[model samples]
Target: MLTQTINPTYFIIDFDSTFTKVEGLDELASIALAGHPDRVRIVDQIRDLTEKGMNGEMSFAEGLRRRIELLSANRQHIDILVDFLRTKISDSFQRNKQFLTEYADQIYIISSGFREFIVPIVTEMGVREDHVYANEFLFDNEGTIVGIDEANVLSTDGGKIKLLRTLNLSGDVYVIGDGYTDYELRESGLANRFYAFTENVQRQRVVQVADHVAASLDEFLFHNKINRSQSYPKSRIKVLLLENVHPVAVQAFEEEGFKVEFVKGALDEDELCERIKDVSIIGIRSKTQITRRVLENANKLMAIGAFCIGTNQIDLEAATERGVAVFNAPYSNTRSVVELAIGEMIMLIRNIVPKSNQMHQGVWDKSANGSFEVRGKKLGMIGYGNIGTQLSIVAEALGMEVYFYDVVDKLAIGNARKVRTLEELLQISDVISMHVDGRKENANLIGKREFDMMKDGVIFMNLARGHVVDIKALVEAVKSGKVAGAGVDVFPKEPKTNDEEFVSELRGLDNVILSPHIGGSTEEAQVNIGHFVPSKLLEYMNNGSTYASVNFPEVQLPKLGNSHRLLHIHANVPGVLAKLNSIFANNNINITGQYLKTNESIGYVIVDIAKNYSEEFIKELKEIDGTIRFRMLY
Candidate 1:
């Protein structure tokens, strides 16, 4: 078991919306005005007032005044509200009740809500009456009418700040609430930080100005390294690999204390879905697909490592929405693919394939009629990305003049020239090679029209996506003597296993060379991908760094020192920084370093703080609202 080290000295929590999912005053109004003629109107008014105050559009004092004036009942209504709130405790807070009970002495509920309802709900969670600071309700002799105790500091705006300042608490003060009033404690320098608690409601006004936003109480606890009981233990974290992802990846995961399961080949969609249900991480090559069904079933999946250059097999949009980070070795296997393209180019240009087949069939026609040297031949390339650029350099070394075209602008490498359009490369070059991606736009990119545009008897090759070329068009071109020969490593439909009988339209053609999609299958490339991808997955799992994740927000975290690291993931909105800083300042937890990164959807913050701290500080951090996920790295 890992030894616990954090200690939190104070826990200032809110009542309505923070601890419970609903506003106490609105609930009270419903019971107090039960069956009254104006009950619906009065309830609506109370709810609007509550939203106004929670969103910082109206002052807490005025909102509280209006809500109290609308309440028609007395002590009985308070008991009813308490009962409802007890049933409506925040899910995360309910799950961590034991942790809260263990530190009940440090937990304080400071709210503008009435003490009559607050006491019963908090006390049920083990909080003592004296620790709860709230407004008091005064009742008539008949207990039928009531008024607030105006003398109480909490009855006015900025009252929480005023009351906390007067107490002069010796330890750090962490404030957790979902309203502008809760933010006052931090703004006025009375508390170390203000956490915008948003488990129930996300008030932008409060979240934007908060020091930190905690989506759930458990998020805060997890960030402070206090409540990780529900997190997957390292030994139990499963990594599933398919399509023969290199053994190095399995070794790397095992070395990092993760349990790894390696399958020899790709699984069908149903098999993948069943296998992924218990996995925390998954590794795959190009064959296996991580569809929506796979992601939906992979409830525990945190990261995916694509052990190849292309991530077309993985459903990235779904992965991002599920908070599953995806990584790929975009450069690890470039050399292997380029070398294969170059070799295939040589064989096709010299018309070696047909002549070799003829010799094997006992045909003794040893004519060098169609054969030509690659020297001075124009080699055209489509999609000038990593592989294309490298192929161009090597082709240039072989005395081949290179011309390429790409959808995006790419600088020429060596003497390779970039053509203005695909048509220009097709018409001018003696040989055309494809290296495009698996994007839908590239489907049949080189079809009938493209074949017609090519110079007569031109050698052709496609080592990129299988669908990037029209195999039928290429076969017709070869049969008609329009294309000299072709080399195709990938096909639109491929056999599932190595031993399966291969099939293709170009199968019987003597001028064509077909391979089982081994462009990036070299041992060196596989090993490199194995080392690169698993290390990235391990980095994210161990440190919460998403530097090269293709899907998640990217953040390059620095090495940790003698301090604890706090990781906060939240909705990408305003005021999160202020809330986090307030928590640190309120607790006097000195931050040695901090790094933050964000995308349109989420914000990630990493803070390295002084090693000496209390568990109470962590609990307070968890109480901030709008936090999606949080972690503490030691």
Candidate 2:
């Protein structure tokens, strides 16, 4: 933390779109016009008016009058709107409620919105009701909102400026809002600074003229050295996404206020080591290898997101040892991989590849000598995981008999039957596809011996890991006519990038399909993996929720409430939890909620406690024995 330097005597904050996440009158219109046929259009019109007033596109008083006339709201609607607005507080302000309580006297709720809705929300945040300043609403005998009180200066243009001048606040007053009028206070030299608050919304015209742009209240507080809920601002967390991960992942990271550095291609080990030193979170697909050396250099790495299904390119043991949580889209791309297998099966059985090639060479070979239909054929699946099960259903839909064999017993899907052994499936299968993972023992799982076990002219496909299949043995099988046609998506020594050349012995084989490891490269699959993997990484980073983490103890978490949350990752050994509990007891720390989960090698603990602690307490926790990584979030 930096030393306190920039201090202001007063903080003037806006109500709608700054303190809260939505415009006040627009929400009122939405509630008042519920079930009305014109609700959407009227609500949208109110929102447009709100935008116009904020941007100075129209007179503030005119916009306010038009919006109030459009809303047929009463006191009952206002009560419901207040309740909804309480839950719709901007995330940054909600997290920094402690700061608001501590400095309530210095903070003023200044806005062009009404005091009726603003007072209830700001008072709950510990702001004094007398300190709140805004426009007043007039209600008739029936408790229906008629219009704003015209006697108030806030009901006219230049309202915020006029209100600030009449109050004549002393010392340096800072303004924080999302509207052009908020900038007018600083422009008129009545305030020290104006921050275009954009946690809820960003008006570019206002942002362009402001002294600074604050993405969140935490950012503004951090820069000014005000005591905030979080020890470090989320803006400081740097995320490095490599290997052209989908843009959806980038958008997710940016939305969390984390600094994102995107690399279109994979980096080598040396390059990655240099770049990983300051990266808090890293995302990658295959091709980028995360070795032990790289993890050692990743001093600040909290989590790793594998945007693909397999994590073979990452060093899971090294990551676990360093207390780095690793996550992957385990089942997000399952459908895409299964669809590719089905497509390849049809193409291979129908001899589509050789026929296409022959046509491209200006030779018309229309004879159906070796072609066969996939219907009524036996389809064998080597693994019974997510991809295998989905493939079984699709293959059965094509009138094919489905057979599968896995080391772990799995329930059959649809008409698929589980064979006793790999040899049994291979002997009985007319078309075989591999879907196993990339475990060490699964290397060369299919070689000469396995190929010899299959019946003559068997159709083979391997969309699994490259090392699982012996390419040389597969080539010999194809040459000797033992295998009719084959589809190989992965290769043992594939090129690192699309620009690099792909060298394979199976390239020129007749009726063979050799793809560049694209079994799950469909657009739909990438988009799904893109959303799934980053969500896991962000959840782990934000709330200590390690659900579905590939290498860490799984502990799903709820949203953090009024207390502080502490996350501790340590070696899974005896006495660690006791030591943690003892430290908490000795330091007089009150634990509100506690959770602990452990794998064979690592233990994860989440504790929500009273938000009072000294630096010495933090130091003690960090120095605890077997502790790997520790973080505090609010």
Candidate 3:
């Protein structure tokens, strides 16, 4: 066996409020209270409850129960809430989504959340659903709130610490987040680095635990391994970064001797195909689509990165077939999003949008008639995954009660009760928000019938998918007074250019809030995306690693101590292995240990031969037929 040398580095991430823009549970509350006047109070309570639990003042189970009982919510509100929550993902996380896809097998989410949300979101990020290890929630035969998977690491105290030790990672470990639970990774010596992300709200306990503190993700990356690494040996690595990826991520790649290229917005399939021909690394956010055609044209691509939380943009099967590795910064921008959702929920609950518009328009219409408090309100959730569960805690702090619903049952979080159906959540909530996944079936999820289910004069918001709601129908609903007000962060057809003219069906409407889909566009979030994405991309290119990869078959090759490593990518056929063995035999090469792994179409073989093998030996192997490609990696 080749002696194992120290590998460069590794990362451990928290799922809920790290990479995504909003706390998943907070979005659930937003959905739950869609049209209710009590929305703001519920959010505050959840937040406070979470803080109390993290500080070791209360049991997680008890804290959760207290918050849920306060909410007094049900199923109807959850359906609409699911879509809103789903849309609150961060741009940074979306941009680096490829890192997880390309390296699907290596990246993991050790969240204290439900699989109902994490599974869908992680799968979209190109991570195998099975790779996600988190708490599971179950429902009864009649679809009522039930028990949780007590054995899950997330449900257990210091569970992430235990899980990391079991991994026995060959490389160094790093952790990033804004919560006390995330800080535990460092306290337990499971992580070599702990980055405190402050783009969202920063906790004193979490800050104290972090080894490195960053205001923006960009600043953090600048101080880390990105630009300060070794010099390039070849023509600089060509990099393409989409808008969602922070410039810092590109800078990090450049630090590793790469030539970084930037694009400020989304790209169509054809455009991506055209731009990726000479690129070694491709990084994008949620809006940039990397289809099968894009993968086929990536002749020089060593890795693809989605700098955001999701990798649904890229065609994973296509990238795998072509052996293109993908990566993403799963936890890099989560706090930013969660923070935003919390802030938005407060803003909406206090009737801040209408007042803000009045102030901006120089009206100064300080009317107390419509303004209200979030305290004592019921908050509902649709997908009680990472952001959802975290939001549940934050909401409790804001003095709000919380309830959640998932198509596939999930664990109760922070006293948040689980509801039976989406319809029940809608009927009970005063404010309804969405936090569902971007599945094909999720298209047009909120239509005329669904909107008609909510309480009249309720606040409605969607931070989730542009495709989930029928935009025109939403406009109609708002106009007809079915919804009291709306805060929409995403639109069905947004302009590609930032300076382009924007027109919307809801324009000229009063008491309606419209955002530029910047829920997680904080400076802190950009910096994290910048810092995390390039590191993942560089790791894949410099070493054939699948950590944080979303595409290609997951493979983590052992570090070869003696250097002469042969990489073979061949068609998966019966004779290929025999032919490779014969080539080694005829050349008098004494192979150390060879690893063979095959997928449906290709077989990847790594052989460690003597460092001083003759040039003729390589030539002989090159002459073998059926070898798709053969070369020395290092």
Candidate 4:
């Protein structure tokens, strides 16, 4: 109905790799020639020809002839191809089904692909059968071998231009496709505009000559001021990826049509607050802090992606209280951290640092007095979490006896023994490796009192939160020989960037491995984190799924189907659900499904309805008591 408000015009669309997610001929070859020895080579040739034709490198007719000669397809194979293509429709096209159905009369699908395939797919999408112009497949009597009808204009190089000229009553015609043929309509003065559709595939030559390149059909419709299923265009959703998030994450966001602003380094509180106000999503690593003040300025913020193992750098409470979902890579870098801990434990226990340092100073002290193998030594783990439990298993594999202590009851792995208290593990073990979280209460968890309880000359390490251990206490204990060589990866106060000077009291200490918080800084770890955290943020943003959110209630949702979904985040007070249902009932809106999840402070409700609602209904939902945030997703 909204299409009625816009200027009337003809919409020319492509079929394969434009209307669908894959090339029809390419997929047809695979299905038709299944179990055939030449299937792969023939399919590759078909795809190559498709690319050549789309890029305008070869004649369209020649490409089509070569592809048809290669595909051993029949009438039955065509039917199977049709079924497969029904599932491969472009994501943007799938979402805008209503727009297609409502404006069926103005739309035309002109593709070089066969009419047998295009008609079944587009007509199902509500386009009139007569509006579909494509090559016809001419089959033999046995229905085994086939060729395209050469007389059809679509079988030629300038087919689209020739066809548009014949149907010349069009007013302000628009061509949308991934091929150069589509742009030919515009170049020949038949079309007013040519949108290079890149939702499924992109050809550079086609892209360069296009009047406008659209990432999706949604984008094209949005550009034309046509109503669509999405509440707002993805291009308008500003994503701010700070602290040099991996390029994989940047590419993922950009592919989804987000306007990404990537900053290579961390921003301070005031700087972040100013930049975050208009950002819908913000991605950060460990250095940048998302404080309550920073969150207060994030008016449009929907999700926060912490591209590291720790969420301590973010204000989870403030993020959740503001109805923002926070996602982090909790187990992505688990192996990296555990490996670092194991490496450090071996180096410190064997006195490798002091020996190596002595050699560097030309002392040549090779005495094996304090040097000892890690074999049979008691290894004490302070936290039995992902990293902690992994370290326990690995240390046990290295022939070290593992002893772990955690406030929460964690099942011991391998021959690892669990202690009820940290003091019990510290008093008995030979090496203490801290692998805890960064909670406020965990600050100074290992102070003078805990250090004094450890055995004399005990090897120690802290690869967990820097604030958990009192650095000054560790320095004094190391000097007094109460604690032997220590490996300290994280620190209480670290410089923002690598260029700044690193000043620490333990800087001059001997036999100490002081790393700059790179326990999980491996390339493998960064890549894993990059892929993981962005996916979680994207899922939360696109589907309202908070499966692994640190603070919000976890809800894993299926892919949204033929329905409009509404996400309502409100204070965890009674009667909110009843009130929401009452509004829907009063409006005669039918609820398809409703999901509710709650945390201590807030409740998250996801409601699915069969049809679109009025703007007044949105206002009613927002005006509901205790409502924190409301968003519509399609």
Over 362-455, each residue of candidate 2 has an lDDT whose tens digit, in order, gives 9998898889999999999999999999999999999999999999989998889999989999999999999998988999999999999998
> What would the per-residue lDDT of candidate 4 be over residues 1-634, giving only the tens digit for each residue?
3354355788999998889998888888899989998888888889999899888899999999998888798989989989999999887888798889888888999998888888999889888999999889898898875788889998987988898899874467889999988898899998999999987777888999999988888888888877787767787789999877789999989877787999987888999989998899999988899999999999899999999888998988898889999999999999999999889988998899988988888988768888889999999999999999899888999999999999998898889999988889999999999988998989999999999999998999999988999988999999999988999998988877777899999998988999998898899998999899989988988898999999889999988888889999999999999999999998888899899999999999999997767879879999999999999888
Error of 4 at 491 (Å): 1.9
Q: Could you tell which candidate, 2 or 4, scores higher by lDDT? A: 2
Give candidate 1 regions above 4 Å deviation. 1-232, 583-588, 611-628
The lDDT of model 2 is: 0.90
- Cα-based lDDT at residue 534, candidate 1: 85
TM-score of 2: 0.75
Could you give candidate 3's per-residue lDDT for residues 161-186 as a string of tens digits?
77777878777676767777777788
Q: Candidate 2: misplaced stretches above 4 Å?
A: 1-8, 14-91, 94-104, 109-213, 223-232, 254-257, 261-264, 360-364, 396-405, 409-428, 448-453, 493-503
Best by lDDT: 2
**What does the lDDT come to for candidate 4?**
0.89
Per model, state how many residue pairs clash: 33, 0, 147, 0
Per-residue lDDT tens digits of candidate 1, residues 1-634? Answer: 1122254467789888888888888888888888899889989998998888877787888888888787788777777778788889876677678766877777788888878888888888888788889998888898864688999999988888878887777677778889888898888887887888876788888899988877667556655556443343454568898888888888887755466798988888999889998798999878888998889999888889988877888888778767788999989999999998888878887778877887898988877888889999999999899899999989999999999999899899999999898889999999899888998888999998999998889998988888888888888998998888888889998877776788888888877888888888999999999999988887888777898888778987776666788888777889998999999999999999998888887788889998778889988777777776677776
**Residue 549 displacement in candidate 1 (angstroms):** 2.1
Model with the higher TM-score, candidate 2 or 3 = 2
**In model 4, which regions exceed 4 Å deviation?**
1-8, 14-91, 94-102, 109-213, 222-235, 244-264, 358-364, 396-425, 448-453, 495-503, 523-528
Shift of residue 467 alpha carbon in model 2, Å: 2.8
